[model samples]
Every structure is written in C-alpha cells, then in structure tokens.
Target chain A: MFEGLYSALEQSEVITLYRHINPDCDALGSQWGLATWLKHRFPLKRVIVLGHQKMTNGLFPDSDEIDDETVRQSLAIVLDTANVRRIDDERWQSARQIIHLDHHPQIEHFADLEYVIDHYAATCEILAEFFSTVDQEPLEADVAEYLYRGLLTDTLSFKTSNTTEHTLAMASYLAQSGLNIPQINRDLFDVPLKEYEFASAIRAEAQILDEHLMISVIDQAFLDRWSMTASQAKDQVYQFGGIREIEIWAVFAKDHDDQRNTWWAGSLRSKTLPVNDIAMNYRGGGHKNAAGCKCLDDASLNALIADLRRRLKENQA
Target chain B: MFEGLYSALEQSEVITLYRHINPDCDALGSQWGLATWLKHRFPLKRVIVLGHQKMTNGLFPDSDEIDDETVRQSLAIVLDTANVRRIDDERWQSARQIIHLDHHPQIEHFADLEYVIDHYAATCEILAEFFSTVDQEPLEADVAEYLYRGLLTDTLSFKTSNTTEHTLAMASYLAQSGLNIPQINRDLFDVPLKEYEFASAIRAEAQILDEHLMISVIDQAFLDRWSMTASQAKDQVYQFGGIREIEIWAVFAKDHDDQRNTWWAGSLRSKTLPVNDIAMNYRGGGHKNAAGCKCLDDASLNALIADLRRRLKENQA
Candidate 1:
C-alpha cells in the first residue's frame, strides 16, 4: 500500500512536508509524524515540515522555512489536505516531486502520487498504520504522540461517527510506545479559565429559536470582552453541540471588511441535516453536516436562520 | 479467577445484584451487565438487580424491588461498592451467600468471596475481561453495551489516568459485538438544552480565587431557577474540571433541613492536590483528588477554601 510513498522517500534526499492552511491537530500530527519517522529511519535525509499557519494551541512546534532553491529540489509530501488550493505552502507547486496523503475525499488532485483514503477517520491513522507495518520495531514515544494527537482530535476523542474498531486498535498500537495518554488528551482539550468563561458566555447568550435550533451571535463588543477574533469566537460553536433538543446550531461572529463595512462570519452544524447547500447560497460552503458562510447584514443573518429552520422542517417532514 | 464466581453462579437458582447508592454509570453497568449475562447464560436462574436510587439520566433502567424472602434465599452479588455501608440495598447481609466484585481498593471483607482489582479503570473493565475470557463465543450485544458504558464513563471516554492499552483492547473486544459505539457515547453524554444553560451559568458564576483555585456557590434561588436539587446541581462540578490554571475547583450548593435552616453541600476536585482531608473535617470524605463535604455556614465554607489553598501552597513549596 505504501510502495510508491516509501520508494519516493527512499529516492529523495530532500523531503518537505505540507498540510492544509489553518492546520488542525490531524494535519500537524500526520505531517510531523511522517517527518520524524523519515528522519529516524534515514538520518541522511533532509526532512522539513513547511507551513505558514501556526497551531494556536501550542500543542506543536512551529513549521520550518526553506528557501525557494530547496523547495525546487525537494519531494513535497502533503498530509491531511484534500486539494492543491488548500495547501499551506504554495511553494509545493515548485517542488521536484509531490505526494499527497489525505483522509479527505478526493478533490482536484495535483500530486505526482495521490493517496487518499476517505474512510479513515484521520490522516494520522493512515500514517500510524503505515509506520507500524513498514518496520518491526515499535514507534518512538514522540512519533506515537504526534500521530495520536491528530487521531484524538479528528475523531473527537473517538466520539465521531467514523470512529471504528480499527481506530481504537490504531490508538492502542500508538499507546504501546509509552505516550502519556491522559496528559496528551488534557493538553489537546483542557481549556484555560478565560476560554471556559467564554464558553459559558456563549451558552448563556445563545438564543434558542426552537427545540430544534439554537444560535449565538457575537458582535464586536462580545469579541472585545473576550479579547478574541471573530474566527476564534466562532469556534465556540461547539458549546451548542451534544444537546438532545438542538438538532441545528449556528454561530455568527461580526467581522469587518477592508473598508470597515460590517459583515458576519457564520458557522453552521447539524445532527443529520445538510448545511453545505445553505452555506453555498451565502457564498460559502463545507460538508453536509457542518458548514460555514457569510452574512452582509442583519437581514441576511435572519435569512440564513430562516433557511436553516426550513431545512430542519424539511428534514422533519 | 472464574472458579469461585462461576461456581457460585452455577449453584445459585436466585441471584440478587446490588450496587452503591446514588449510583454512577459504572455501578449500574456492572450490576446490570452481570445480571444480563447470568440470565442469558442460565435461563432458569432468576437474576434480580436491587437498588433504591435511580439513574437520573435514564441511561439505564430502574432497579428491581424484590421481597425480603427472595433476598434471604438468594446469593447476593455486590458490584462496584467499596464497603458494606454504601451498598444501596442492605438486605445483602440476609442472603444465603454473598459475592463482591469491585475495582476499588479493598476496604473490608463483608462478602464470602471478594474480587477486587484496584488497578482496573472500572469494575466493568474487570467484568469485561472475566466475561470475555470465560466464554469462547462473543458476548451478546446487550451485555457488551452495558459493560462498555461503564468503562467509557469511568475512564471519561478513555481520558482518565488509569486508562491503559488494555482498556482500549477491552473496548475493541466489546465493539466486536457490533455495538453502536457512537450512539452509546451520545446517549451517555448528550445533555438537554437546560443542562447546557446550567453549565453556562456555572462557568459564568464561578469565582477564580487565584490561578490555582476556583469556586461556584449555588444558592436556593439558583437551584429554583434551574428546577434541580442541590445534589443534581452539585453534579455540574465537572464543568470546573480540565482547566489549566485551576489546580483545585469546587461547587457548594445550598440545601435546607426540615426546620428550613440552610446548609451547604460541596463537591471538591483537584488536578493533583488532596482534598479528602478537608472533606473529613467537614463530616465527609472521599478520594484524595475528589471528595465531598458539608459546611454549616459561610464561615465553614471559607475555612474549607482556606484549607484547600493551604494544601496547594504546600504542594508548591
């Protein structure tokens, strides 16, 4: 299964890893896990993890920077990204060769060798399986921890629908490296008191439109009180999740254009209803159950909510 | 390991199962899991689960009520309770024979046969291992689901300190029964909108005494707003957990005596500091990191907080 990827690694003296922009734990996990393994297995190889965006949680180290000459000569292996447009470092287009390793559905592929397994819960799951099978020795603690973080977050601590027996088996395999499981979970999940306060505020201020729908609107004042960006505040949409009565939850955080015109950046989630269609209607899009969009004004926001309520009603019917 | 428990099961025609008062998932899971297994394995044997308290969440069915004559004739099996005093149904003493299975440290030997393995993450973990090994065929879906619920809750979805590779392996074994793991997790954890609002209120109302300590005081008025009892309110203490700065967090809910005099019931938790000593001083005690206590007045609550602060200070020193 890993023949082409393994041969590419063995053939390339210089390898640079990249992942999607606004990288999550799984992206960083798969990128660094494979890099760490490559460096260990072939000490002479020049391996680099290249990305412009940072993991804001401080769970991972910063990405490496290389000159254009190095990018032009390196084997650029992209991890956890579905398509070329989302690659954090566009310099991958200039690399001597490209290999895409992803768990997302196949999009417009640009890699010389594309490997996408959508059924896997996380990109790190594939990497863990690959690493464990390619060698007889157990993975080092650092490598296992890096890969495990991605698996943990992407699967939402194995609470997501895609989590399977194989997922737990892979987790058990990674855990055998003596990684501190509780501490890692704590590091990835444990929030600061301020964030807790923010979540509390979100829940407190949330407007329950009906038994099936809930919404939280974060304006400039709310953002100022929490000292966070609109995007960051929007991330608290999860606070509305896992409520039995709330089949659909949305968060709208007020942002401004370059001209300082008011706009609302919105995130939408559902238990089973499709949301990406509504997101696309507002010049934004994502998956069926979870999506993102924008609103130009209060009327647009109201329209968005109305559209979601309609979707819920349609689903009920 | 199986010789004693299995022989007792085989010899008994009527078996009564008991667990601790105000039972959590582990207690109920172990009791019902064993009862269900025994009933399936021996169709003629009557297995009854006896408990007075209800699982407020409705995750498990209500306990059975049996006549004293049945208790006196049956073999009583106590699961998940550490000591005799805490058992929900005290009629176990009258049973013809008694068997105790628990994962807590052995407090006393009240049962004729005791199986205590403190290292296991949950009593359900021990039960799962026992059931899987004793039978070559896979456990029925209902039995595996019941036990899996306990293991999942006790380990906090495998995030607890005690969770090991064996825990995941046991979970995998349970998953082999084609259990709907995601649905079980959802049922075990998903809360109603009102509870979400209450959690928000707790976080909003929490007082950060310092970087190391946080407290939330819930009065009768607050309980009335939520339409929940002080004990039910106290269960929200977990909302204060998993915070990076707060080494110790607590919740004190006001309850009244028959005379209408107000008192406070408190739940305390710490990341590493011991709070049981202070709890013992306040007419209560529990594990080192987690404990419960009572305060007669505001001054006593202050004193308890002071004691916790002192413990944290000592640890830092």
Candidate 2:
C-alpha cells in the first residue's frame, strides 16, 4: 500500500516527519511510527520528527528536539495532516521532496506525493501496515507502545465507527509484539487529583448557549494555574457530560504564546452542529462534530457566534 | 439498506422494544425512537418498550418502563443489545415473534428476525433508517430528543469511532425537532458534588494490576451512602483520562438487588481492554472493551481475573 511512498523516499538520505496543528495522537503516531520504522529499516539514513505547533505534552511523553534547518535538502513526509496551512513546519518548502499519508477526507492536497487512504481507521493503522507489509523487523516494545497508543487514541480504543477489522487486526498484531496494553492504559488514563479539580473548574465555568448549544471560553486567566495542552482543555469539556441535545459544545482557550493576539484557540463539538463549516469560516477546519478555529478578539468571537446562531437557525428551518 | 429488516417486521401487529441492561441514553433512545415511530405510523398496533433489566435510575431523568409479561406475548423487538444470553428479557423464548436491531458486532443467532447492522454508528441510526423507510412522521421534540440522546450516548457525542456521517445527519435531523440539547446535557452529565467525593473514594479503592489494568469494585455500602448508579460508577472509571498505554480500567459496582451474595455488575471502558470476553466466561457478556458479569465472591472474581491474565498472556505469545 505504501510502495509508492517508500519509493519516493528511497533516494533521499535525510528524512523528517511533520503533522498538522493541534496535533492529535494519529498525527503524532503516524509521524513517530514511520520515523521508528524508517530509522530502524535504513539506519544509514538520518530521520527527524518535528511539527510546527506544540503537541499535547501529556500524550507525547517522549520527544525529539529537531533543528528546522538540520535536514539539508532532505525528504519530508507529512502524516495525518489536512490543509497545508496547518502543516507543522514551513521547512518542508525547502525540502527536496514531500510525501503525505493521511486518513482524513481531503480538503487540500499539500504534498508532491500523497498517499491518502480515507478508508483506514487511523494514521497509526497505516504506519503499522507499512511496517508489516515491507517485512520490517517487529516493533520494539516502546515503539510498539507508541504505535498502539496512537491506534487506541484515534479509534477511542475501537469504539468508534472508523474502527474496521483491519484496525482490530493491527491492534491484535501490536499486542502480539508484547506491547503491554494495561500499563499503556494506566499511563494514558491515570489522572492526578489536581487535574480532577481543574476539570471541575472548567465545568463550573461552562454555561449554556440557548438549548441547542453550550459555550465556554477558557481565558488564560482561568487556565494559567493549570498546565495543560489545548487537547487537555478540550477533553475537560466532556466532564460536564451528557449534553445529548447540544448541537455544539465549544471551548475557546486563549493561547498566550500565540504572537497573533487575535488567534485565540477555539474548539467546537456538535452532534447537530455543522461546526466544521463554522470553523472553516474562521480559517480553521475539522469534522462536523469536532472542529477548531481562531478569533482575534471578543468582537470577532461574537461575530463567529452570530454566524453559528444562523447555522443553528438553519436547523430550525 | 433495510429491505431485509423491513420485510421481517412488516406484518407484525405488536412490537416491543428491548435494549441491553443498565440502559444508557442510546439504549433508551433506540427504544423510545422506535416506539415513537410506531406510535405515529402504526397507530393501529400496540408498541411497548421492555427490558430484562432496569437501567441505572439516576442517569435517566425520565422513566420509560414496561413489564416482562408484555415481552412474552408481543413481537419482541430487541434494541441496542450486544449479546444473546444477556438479551434483557428471557421472554424471547415465548414471544410470538422475535426481531432484533442492534449495533454491536454479531454475538449470537438469537433473533428469528434479526437486523444486526454492527457497522452503523449507533442503534438510533438503525432506528432512524427504519423510520425513514416506514415514512414515520418527522420526529417529535421529545422523541427526537430521546433519539438524539441514544445517538450521543452510543457515539460518545460524535467523538468515538462509531460515529459516521449518518450519525451526524441523524443528530442534525433530530436537532430540527427542537428538544433542548443543553438541558439534557446538564441533566445527563452534571453529577452532584457528593458524587465527586464518591468518585474520589472509588478511585482510592481501585486495585492496580501492574499499571496495565486497574480494577475497582464498590460494594452496597458505598451505594447506600452515595445513592449513585452503576452507570455513574462506570463514568468514574472513564474519568481517569490521559494514559496512552493502559489496557483495562474497570469499575465493578455491586448491584444490591441482584442476589443475596452474588454481586451482579460489569465494566465500561474506552476499548482499551477485552473485559467483555472476561465477563462472558463468568456467565456474563458484552463488547471488546465494555462488558459485565457477576462474581459470586472475591474468589470467583479472582478466578475471572486469572482467566483474563491468561488471555492477555496468550496474546503476547
């Protein structure tokens, strides 16, 4: 399945991996999983994994610091990314070649050589297939642990619709490689007492947006005390769980490091809300139920809210 | 997609809905959504919702009940069931006719007229398709709200792998029916402050299995003080968020009414472990990550644990 992808990278001596902004496990897993595969397969080649944005620190417990200019005219492979605007590093523009492997429905094609499989469940699944297909050595436990985590995280542990027999088979195969399922689970799920308290604070801060939506924007003031990634902030929103009727549950957290003051990070969810369409309006994107975007100020955020109300109004029609 | 299912139930005059035990919103929504559809489209016939077990009461703010005798006499329509033996009502044996509609993977060949579309996102998706085929009235606000709940609960509010385009579409369609999403959310997700303390207590009680699987079983003593449901207990287990490697995280709460000594209950998870299979071996059954069974005593539960460890060990081999 990845024959063309490998062939494109075969000639390149140096390789780097990148993912989209607000990097999810799939994006990180694909990037990291492939890095593990390639570095192990071709030890002679230099491999690097880097993304432009900061990932959820809690999820990516292991990291490799990369110098953007380190890969002299090498190949860069972007995995589990969508639009080019969200690409982790612009250094790819200086690379000699670029390849893309993703499972998302296409929005914009970014790579010179793209290997997108919309049918696959997760990006890690694709990477696992790549390693298995080429008869590469079996995954090392820590490497297998990361790959498995990506699969479990992306598939919500095989509870989602995207889970296919292939996903399960790959997970089963990874388990066979002696990746400890329970320990990985504990590390991923064990929460500190403070985190629980922070989640309560978020829930207490959240409020309803009409009967159809719930909205909360966690300003830096509320979040400064609690160290968390955007995804952690997003996951905290589910704690006020059981909002079945909510077409959209939104969280806009202020990221102070953002040089663009107007670029307040926003997260949206809706079983009924066409949030991706709304996010697109803000020059961001995601699926219908979960999407994110940015707003410059209260004025812009209010304008976005007005637009969302109109979308909710459309449902009324 | 539903032609085969339509024919099996076309001639039936009476239909009774069934869902898995300890019902969630999706379970209820699947049941209520179908009952509402029948109420309007087949007004001449009688439709009832019945289950072999009662749901966790506190979670469901409203009551929708039926007697077992109804299942024995009517055309039993089981909804959202995962396994055959655990079919809510044993009345399936004597029911004049039996029809099954479920979203879980095929577990058994119990239903004489079964519609098992495991690939569909939620049980409500199956009902949505069935209603669309039957030309049922556009969903009522309450019915639509209930259906939306079922969809959200089962789909984990569009975050799980089970979510599909159809899942979102059905949620959108239901949103048009005007049931309050935020209100339902508040009722569904908002646990009392007391429950938080209870959750803390439960977490403290959990037994760690090498940081791989964490098991916590609360007895009746905990229940009386907190007045929490098994569903709430499960939510507490899921609250430990962020570990990427743990496989099985379970909350086995005692169901006081089950028997004098046998503790009847099961576990819920994010598909990290195969607890359902473990539950099945103990005369219980469920899905890959979510399953329940009874432990007549601590020794029985320990034997069950031994079996699970054996399976995980086999996987490593």
Candidate 3:
C-alpha cells in the first residue's frame, strides 16, 4: 500500500511535513522520524517540517518557516493528522503532491496518496512498519528515538487498550537501533513544579458524589483561586479518573461561546458504562468509556448530574 | 550461568517455585511463568508454586499443600527474592538443589546456584531471557502473560530507571508469544473501588512542606477511620512520588512492633535528590531515590521531617 509513497520518496527532491494543530508527541515524532529517515537515506533531498504551536520544551527542532512557493515545489507529507482541516499549515494544499500517513479513523479522503492504519496505536507505528519494509539501514538511532517517543506517549507507555504484541515488537525493533529509553521516558513525562502543585490542588478539591460519581468543577472561582484558565484546570481531569471507588467521573468548567453566551463544558468518563450515549444526548460525544459534552447554564449542569446519577443507579441495579 | 539450571530442569522429576514474602506482581509472575513454562515443556515433571500470602484478588493461583517429603524430592527455584529470610516457604532448603533468579541488589547468599542481575528491571526479565535461550517452544501464551505482568508492574509499565532495552526486548519477545497486554496491565494496576477511594482520601489530606516536599501522614486515628493498616497506607507513597513540585515526599503511619514498641514507620522518596542519606541517618535505608525507616515517637518523626527539610534546602542550594 505504501509502495507508491516509497517510490514518491525516492523520486522527490524536496519534501514538506505537516502534523495536526496542537501537535502531540505522536505527531511530532512521526513527522521528525520520517524526516530524519528520509534525510539520512536521501542526503541531497530537502525536507522541511512546518507547524504553528509547540508543546512543553523545544526538544524537537523547530518547524521551518517555508513560503508558499517552497511548499508548491515540494512533495507535502502530512503525518499523524486525521482531519483535513486539522492540518497546521494551509500551505500543504500548495504542494505538488500529498501523502497522508495516519493511525486515526479515516474521516476524509484528503491526500492523493493515503496510508491509514487505525488498528496501529500511533502514526509512528505505521511509519516504523513502513520504514522497516523499505531499507533498514536508514532507520538510525535518532529516527528510532523519535518514533519510539510517539509510540510510547500515544499508548500512554503501552497502558492503552490498542497496545498489542505488534506495538511491543515495533518498540523493541526501535530499541534495537540504540536509544536511551530512560531519558526518553523522563523527557516526555517529568512534569514541572507548578503543574505538580496544581495537580495536588485538583486532587484535594475532587468531590465523590453518591458514592459512585467523582466530580471536580473548575469554575470561575477555582480559576480565580488558582490563577489558571478553564482549559488549564480541566487538564487535571486525569487526577480524578484513576480513583477506584468512582465508577463514573466528570470535570466541568465554566466557559463562554463566541457569542459571549455562558456555558459549562464538561468531560465525562466511565470505567465500564457507555457515557458516549449520554454525551451524544447532550450535544457532544466520544468513545464508549470516555466522552464530553457542554450545557447552556447551571440548570443544565444540574440536570446532567441528575441524569448521570440516574444512569449510575440504573447501571448498579 | 543458567547452563547448570537447564540441566537440572531437564533431569529433575519434581520442581518447586518460591517467591518473595508479601509477593508483588513481579514475584508471582516469575514464579508462575517459570512453573507454567516448565510444566508445558516437561510434562512428566511435577511443578508447584508456593507462597504464604497473595496480592489483591487471588488472580494468581494458590500455593500447593505439599509436605517436606515432596519438597526434598524437587529442584527449588526462588524468583524475585533478594534475601533468604524473605522467601515465603522455608521448605526450599529441603530441595535436592536450589536455583535463585533475581534482579535485586544481592543482600544474602542462600541458594546453591544463584543468578542475580541488579541492572535488570525485574526477575521476569532474567527468567524470560533464560527461557528464550533454552527452548523457544516452551514460551507459551500463558507463560508470556505471567512474565509480561512481572515485567510491566516491576518497571511501573516501563517508567522505572532500570527499565533497559533488554527489559523491553524481553517484554516484546513475551508479547510475541501471544498475550493480552491490556488485560495484564489492568489486572496488575487497575485498583478496585475501595482502594481508589482510599487513595483519593490520602491525596486530599496530603500536605506540602518547605514549599518543595509533599508529605502524607496516615496516623493511627486516620487508619482507624479508614480501617486500614500501616502497610496498606504506606503503599500509596508512589502516588505522591511523581508529582512535580515535590523534590522529596514521605508517608508516615503510626504502628507498633511485635515487642509492643510504639513507632511511626514510614517510606521516603525523592525524584532527583539524594534521600537515602537522610533515611540512613534515621533508622531506615533504601536506594538513592527511595528508602524506608521507623521512628520511636512523635519527636523522632518531627526530627526526621526537619532533617528532610534541611536536606531539601541543601539540595536546592
């Protein structure tokens, strides 16, 4: 399936890379891993990676400030992005040809050459598999390190459900290329001091309702108290997710829409129950176990809680 | 090193497995994994796994009720045990010959034949490597699942410092033999409702000291309220270790020794600082990052806290 892309890589003199907006380790890793491999294999070819936002520290190299003309001259390769609109660079459309490499469910047939493996944990896994099929010598230490980070972070260090024997095999294959596993783990996971303290505060404020539901609301008051944004406060939702007694959990935050209408945005999670149905019912959606939704005001938030409680009672019964 | 052990496995008609006391996933995994592999390969040979206590759910099988006569006829293998006193079954000494496989710093020489690799993350890694070298056919799915659990849990799903490329390679090899990585992870890590609630309660009561250290005390009254023992409370120390602002953290629980001596037993942890020195200054010892100790009274506990504060101040300076 990637034979065309392989041939394209061999034929192309210049390549440009694009990942999803607000790129994660998987997106950056796949983008960089592919670029490193291509550059090492074809030393004469030009490879440019472009993105708008950055995560954490600038551990990976910065995205190139390439012009539209440059993008028009190069073969644009987008990695780890599912939706067409989610691509960071609008200039990706100006490229001579487009190749999409992803591990997300295919929502759009945007690329001229597409390779999507939804079963694989990360785009890096797909890229690694493809790299393995081509020349093995080009998959150097640096390339392996980047790909491994993507795989590790995407799977939450192989704790996710999608992680399989193939995931471990791919990880092992990359490990064989010689990389510091411990350092990589640290660089990707070690949190800053303020973030850690903030997490402690979130944990302290978590409320266990009805002996089954764990809810933490980071409303305006919480934001004011912590001097953080709603999004920043909501990111600590994971702190409440792992609680044993809580069969269901939610993190609600106060936010406003573009029209300046007040709303309560919340992320819902469950261990076994289907919360996506509830999320969908509330004009939002996600997977079976994890989901999210938004309500117009406090009354709707109360109603949603009541609905969740009723669902919990029904679930227990 | 395992050449003699391979010969023993081939020649012996009976085999017995021993793990460390208060056995964790790594100990049980190695024991069951080796037993399962041996039983599958050498059908005629009888194999038994022995342990005094079990972890959370009796997910691992129980120790057999065998007499000293049966033990005397078997080749004993102790897995993931550092010291002879820590071995669950005292009957191991009665075996025809003994083999010790561990990944802890050697504290005692008890087994007739010992293979200890401190650099490896888990004993399962050593056993898996040995199994790989001996006969590939014996490394069945059941064996792989058990070994993978040990590898995963001991390394905290490859978050530990000792988790090397060999550890991951061993895990990958086991994974390739056909095992559910997600299920294994859940079985080993996913806490029950009660445990999760207890963890939340602990987190709620956590205190930040000296602006850098996070401390949680599960005193006698708190234990009585929660209906938990000191050991059960101490286990939650890992929950605090990963938080960012905390350079050092400690969990202190009030308890009494066998002699009715009132004391506060506690575990100490540091993310980057040298905490073992402070632990050693008191009546405790551990690695550079993690250690344990006991204090006679409240004064000693306060003294320990002051020492830790001073250490933290010194560390920062």
Per model, how many backbone clashes are there? 0, 29, 3
Angstrom error at residue B46, model 1: 2.9
Question: B194-258 in candidate 3: lDDT tens per residue?
Answer: 77667777877789898888889887888888898888888899877665467888889888878
Stretches of candidate 3 exceeding 4 Å from the true structure = A1-4, A40-43, A56-58, A133-141, A204-211, A310-317, B1-4, B106-113, B133-140, B258-260, B296-299, B313-317
Candidate 1's residue-wise lDDT over A1-317, tens digit each?
A: 88888899999999999999989999999998998989889999999999998978987888887899999999999899987788998999999998989999997878899888898899999998888778887799889999999999998998887787778878888887877887898899999877877878877778987578999989999998889888888888988888989989989999987888889999999877889999898878998888999755888888888998898888878
Error of 1 at A159 (Å): 1.1
Fnat per candidate, as a fraction, reads 0.74, 0.09, 0.59
Compose the digit string of candidate 2's lDDT tens values, residues B49-121.
6664556645443434556666566787788887766666566667888777888888777777778888887
Residue-level lDDT of model 3, residues A1-317, one tens digit each, is 67898999989988999999989999999999999998888999999989988866666988778778888999999888888899998889889999988999999988899898999999999988888888646368999999999999988899777787678778877877767776688788777767766777776677888998988877777777777766777677776665556788888888776796778888888877888888887878999988888764788888888888999999778
Docking class of 1: medium
Residue B178 in model 2: shift from native, Å? 28
Indicate the residue-level lDDT of B13 in model 1: 97
TM-score of each: 0.92, 0.52, 0.91
**Between the candidate structures 2 and 3, which one is better when assessed by DockQ?**
3
Off by over 4 Å in 2: A6-22, A42-76, A82-98, A104-112, A119-121, A136-140, A155-169, A189-192, A217-235, A240-242, A252-265, A276-287, A296-310, B1-317
List residue ranges in candidate 1 displaced over 4 A.
A3-12, A68-73, A93-97, A112-114, A135-138, A315-317, B1-13, B65-75, B93-97, B134-138, B314-317
Quality of model 3 by C-alpha lDDT: 0.84
